[model samples]
Target: MNAVLRRHAGYYLPFLALAAVLAVFPLVASTNMVNIGVFALIYGIAAIGLSLLMGLAGQVSLGQAAFFAVGAYTHAILVTRYDVHGLVAAVTAVLAAMLVALLVGLPLLRLRGHFLALATLGLGIIVSVTVRELEYTGGTSGIFGIPKPEFGGRVYDSPREFFWLLVPFVVVGLLMARNLVGSRTGRALSAVNDSEVAAECLGVNTFLLRLKVFVLSAGYAGLAGVFYAYWLAVVSPEAAGFLLSVHFLLMVVLGGLGTVWGAITGAVVVEGLDEGMKALIPRIVPGATGEVQLIAFGVALVLVVILLPGGLAQLWEMAVSRLRRRGSAREPGELPTVAVREGPRDDVPGTGEVSLADLLAEADVPERGTVVLSVRGLTKRYGGVVAVDDVDLDVRAGEILALIGPNGAGKTTCFNMISGVLEPTAGTIEVLGSRVEGRAPHTVADLGATRTFQNLQVFGSSTVLGNVKVARHLRSRSGVVRGMLGLAAREEKEIERSAMASIAALGLAQDADRSVTDLPFGRQRQVEVARALALAPRLLLLDEPMAGLSGAERDELAELLRRARDAGVAVVLVEHDVDAVMALADRVAVLDDGRLIALGTPAEVRNDPAVVAAYLGTDDEADDIVRHAAQEVR
Candidate 1:
């Protein structure tokens, strides 16, 4: 109950306070103050869209004001020129904005960071200039005479009346933004922001994701513009000016980039400051309001950058964290804790003796077992560099094959080729005997080949369990549209259960609800592995799964891999840990400079002269000969 109260107070107190001010300000303040409040609400809405672009998808867009103006113009034209109903005009404006966003985003979202910002800044300038020059848009004088929206013989004519009208939309927009950031779309967007290359490797289409977010953000800006048009009963080129774009950018940077509620708070604070400055500067400084306010804005922005670079959300987080730390320090080790039970160890039934034949039979692939995958003459080249040179590999049902190599030996390149990431310069990849080469990465993943990266690629923003749940979506009956509509075929209960199970598989059950960032590095690696295993692929490709793990963790992973193999899943292992590889591999393949050097049983490979030279260097002949002679008879 206390935690609930704290959470509500942390998240909703500002909103509740704003609600009270909006409700009572009309009675206490002048009509002008009420107008200022309404304008703040509209700016808040635009800021949410800008926040989505800059914060979530990691795209820096300064053209939100352009999209904003386009929406206002759309609403103005539809209502005045086409005689469209006010509500219909609002909807049309949003759709039109999305269309413009799509056209702009398809090309502009292709650019990264500074380039994106420059492109968007150019777009905003274009929109501002176009609005000024186009006669249909009323030129520099701006469009006027837009009447208040009327519904069922009722019209909102006064500022006070429109405050009541706009408040609900402001609330709804906040909720919608919150819901979006918490959904799959939000997670994917955050992932893209953090690392586009990593997200692409995870089968996320970074291009389409950027475009989707671009359109969504523009749609929100459009809706806000429509509301602004109706509220003001006029439209102006200033609505899409470079200054307005800068203001939205300031809001995002000040409030917090990635959090929805932060965007809301940022919009209110920045716009409220603008209004306060407008009122105060004119009264105190008389004729210097314009220059004085610009100087003050610049100084305030500098202070914000210096003092709170991570933004207001980080400030709030820091404050709360400090309070929690103080409270926890008062009672050391009393916070909360969880215990994990290890799974039962494998043993011969009621026997003290364990036979090698039995162990080999249990670990071995059966005759006529499903051939889950086949790779034939797979070759990849980077210019004159042969990254993977005519490699042939197969993964049979229920077998674990380890790929061992020194650095730069093309193991990863082979994995990439098989996973459909790098299109092979030559060769065929087949899943279940069906040729599937040159397919997209997601298509290869959908066809039952899932992999984990050498370096951890866990979604740090999401909970540990949430990371795994996303992989479950690969097999989900629901499409993206269906999930957005809350009509996913699988029940929430089932997804939750599956997610928990996957989390448990890697002994991360205790950390399921914890943000992956908070976990130890080894555990984060486990989360990555669990996420890949959640796909339930017929063949799993683990790229250095034991990398950066402790002795205990390596043992746990080896046991987990053994259990997975026993359960009828084929695995391709790539690791530098020779001890673990020798213990776990049924067959080991060695590579040297993108060419296969040796393929044999662990005993044979351990003694192979070529393998020793590739690993220990050719100069260590005395040690190599002794080691080879010792292991040759094994």
Candidate 2:
């Protein structure tokens, strides 16, 4: 109930208020104000498109104007030269623009950050130049005699009547955009934006998702372009130039990056400022109209970037929260929730739902097994250096197996072979009674296997819920189109319930809506674990789960891991923290120079002479100790 109210309260309430204002606006405001509203609506459409691109897809597109122009020109040609209907031409124009965006974004979207920005910028410049040079576009003069739509056999003759006509389309467009951005596909775009690597690991096709968002963004720009051409009865190169594209980007940034209403707010505020300054400049500075306006606009943008990086939406949100707090104050004797707390529960079971025995039985892995993950005579060499040399190891089920060595011990290389990140040159890898060698990482993951990276791999820009949701996608039975259309899947509600349950299990319900960036390092680590758990794998490989954690945080994580093990999940933990390995691991494997020198219970491995000697020696000297120990054991 609270969620429903929160959803409707923010922009929906404002939208309702705006409807009232728009209804009475024509009667109260001047003709100029009405004109401004129409213009703002059109600009809002473009802003919405750019927001989906730059904000949602995490692509920096400085070429929105190019797509915008394609739409406008396509409509102009279809309606005038080809004698097509305005409505049909408009739809065709949008499709044409989307095709163009897809074709261009396919290759260009592969580039990261500024590379994408610059590439799109180049595309915009090419478009602007082409339009200016082409005879069909009327060069610098542009195309004229663009036909306006005649609806119900009556032409829209006046600007006021035209405003009413455009307003509905604008509203419809906004609704569609809202729906697109609010759905699962929309969240996927955000996931890619946040972290492409992590998204891919979660079974998201990042490239395809990028293309999808590019097409959607371009489609919106295309629709807006058609509206602009019909409203002005002109199509020009200047209308979709690089500067115009920048203007759209600035609008989204000034409004808010991720919020939908921010686009409209940004468009209205910035465009109104532009118009107001144009009017005031001539009166105040005489002939310095252009120069003065640019100076003022630049300064305003800098101020916004510095003071309101979250933009107007965040500012408004903060204001409303403050207002609510002020409206109701606590009595002097009333204690805060923070001041009251229940004691810990001794009855609550640990993290996993099943016992270790069950997990081993399900995977057909023995409690004291033969090799579950074995590498024999494994060697990976680059040029003259051998990264992993004739390494042999075994990982048993139902044990916390620790793989630890110095930075260049090829510990990662060994893991790469086991998880199928790299091919072993001279060995076989048998996982779960199959010769699962040289498969892709995803293929490895699909075979009851899941692994985390050594480096932090949380989707930083996405909310805690968003990150976990991506994890659940691997298990989601719904297809892409179903999610986009907001259709009820076979188990849509069930999937949602399951995702929430996973979040709750991680004790992250309080931080569910908060972005990973907002959380501390320890919480982000927990988020990663939550994601892995969502995969529902039998063999869970954790790479340094406690890296960069505080002592207290590490202790808590250790307890969490113990609970997970207790719940029938087999875990493989790789860490350099000897104390943590000793405390949490049922059995430990010590890796030096890519070969396992010692593998036994924590007490046995800790007491191993070779294990002690390897730690005592320098990083380089450890490899010799591993070799000697392996020979001695054999």
Candidate 3:
């Protein structure tokens, strides 16, 4: 219990210090400075939400100000016109903003990059124009006479009082944001950001996850809006303008992209700069316009991007790392390179010095010969081009089936169709008896199928353990709310243990906490396999898993696959290494020009006259392909 408390204290001490500073600021600062602090805290809440959407989820939004205005105007209207309680009105306003985000996000989240940004910008414009023209919104003049929040017969009416009132909200918001970014949901969001297709194959519904983050972000903006309405006791159309939205984006960017503290730091910096300019500009230029402040902001943004692209948060991290390194003996960012102790040698030829019995022993082998994947007449076409012609395949438990062909033979297309990354032009795919041909990738994954990509899709920004943990998405049941509330701590620990087991099984335990991008290409491939194995899939698809590996690495991977087969995994490997495939596969299926030409035991397929003519083009090449297979089987 003490150890857990100490760990949590280390994690939260910075936030507690920040809250203390915020609480003490109003007591010492002048009224004008206190007012600026109030605005900063209010905008900090919205900026944190935007950070989660853009920084973590990699979804861009340019309509945060519209949501902010919705909250402010909704609260103002309810308080002034209907005489509603401030607390109830605040909740209602936040819900209204979330509803708007939900309606807008359903279709808009489908768009990517600048298209999504533009769509969100249009939404902002529509909201701004509607609020300006509507009578209930008080048109261009905006709503007035908003009531101040009262609690226990005490009213927060002054700038100092409001600043103090906002400190708790900002602190709670930061705590929740911190909790979320360290949870399973946050890891999945990072996975989606890194590779949406990879995340989907790991059983994450990318569209739904993006939509949920959007709605949550809008709720944050709305909460900020509620406070903004009460702070001024009036709401204006300008509050919902494009400029405010841009400022919110700027806050997150200037603070840091992926850190929760970046949001508050950015809000404070932007607000402070604006206030400083207002006071200093008049004295320097006598009649300087607001455009001068805009120019200053642009210059500052450019400088920050060029000098510190990761923003102020990056600078803080660097400083803290330096301090820790100075105090400790170890160098910063240095990871241990200790290898796992080798086990007893096995009977398998060319199995190398390292043994995998300890690694593979824990896998629960099902009844052998149980068919795990079935495909019949599967086809894929692009206009006049047929990528994959009618193909039939079945993979049973306890066997490794190699799908071999030349480049552009539609090997990957078959894998894509079977894994549900692409819809088949015709025919069916069943994994563990569930029809999955036209279903989404997540659905396929949920039915106990997982795959590794030809071009590596490991999450570059995450640690090896982190990458593997994302595969446990379907296995874990915690959602965004539970993650944010820190209710999934126990589940997260179990996930880490499972992920570590997979990493260890793949001989990557030493590098488990290292960022995957820092590893060699071969190691990264191992990471991908570790992630896939963590899913505990009944059927595993490997699109050239051995590509770019060394001879020794190839042997290691081959042995690993054999162990997986022994453990009742159904593996379909697509590869160009004929010797490795011939020696490793129980059966080989050959494809030529999108058509299956042969399927049989390695010897049977290699000696087939048609396969020899079509695949290798001659008997000499076919002989060369099977030289190793004959030696291994004998």
On residues 1-634, what C-alpha lDDT tens digit does candidate 2 reach at each position?
5654675477457556666666667677778877887788887888888887777778889999999999999999899898998889999999999999989988998898898999999999999999999999889999899977789988875667777776666665666566667666676667767666566556566677778878888998898898889888999998779899988888899999887678888998988888887787777777875888888778877887789889988899899999978876789998533211122111233332332233233433345444457667888888778888887766665556777766777877776777776787878877766776787655666665667778777877677777877765556655434554546333444444455555665667667777778888778888887777666656778888888778887877777677656654567888886667766777777777766677787667755788777753546565454455344333
Q: What lDDT does each candidate get?
A: 0.76, 0.74, 0.87
Best by TM-score: 3
Q: Which stretch of 10 consecutive residues in model 2 shows the poorest summed lDDT? A: 338-347
Q: Candidate 2, residue 243: CA error in Å?
A: 1.7
**TM-score of every candidate:** 0.86, 0.80, 0.93
Ten contiguous residues with the weakest lDDT in model 1: 351-360
Candidates, ranked, lDDT? 3, 1, 2
> What is the number of residue pairs that collide in model 2?
3
Candidate achieving higher TM-score, 2 or 3: 3
lDDT of predicted model 2: 0.74
- The better-scoring model by TM-score among 1 and 2 is 1
Go through the candidates in order and give the clash count of each: 0, 3, 0
Over the full model, what C-alpha lDDT does candidate 1 score relative to the true structure?
Answer: 0.76
Highest lDDT scorer: 3
Clash count for candidate 3 is 0
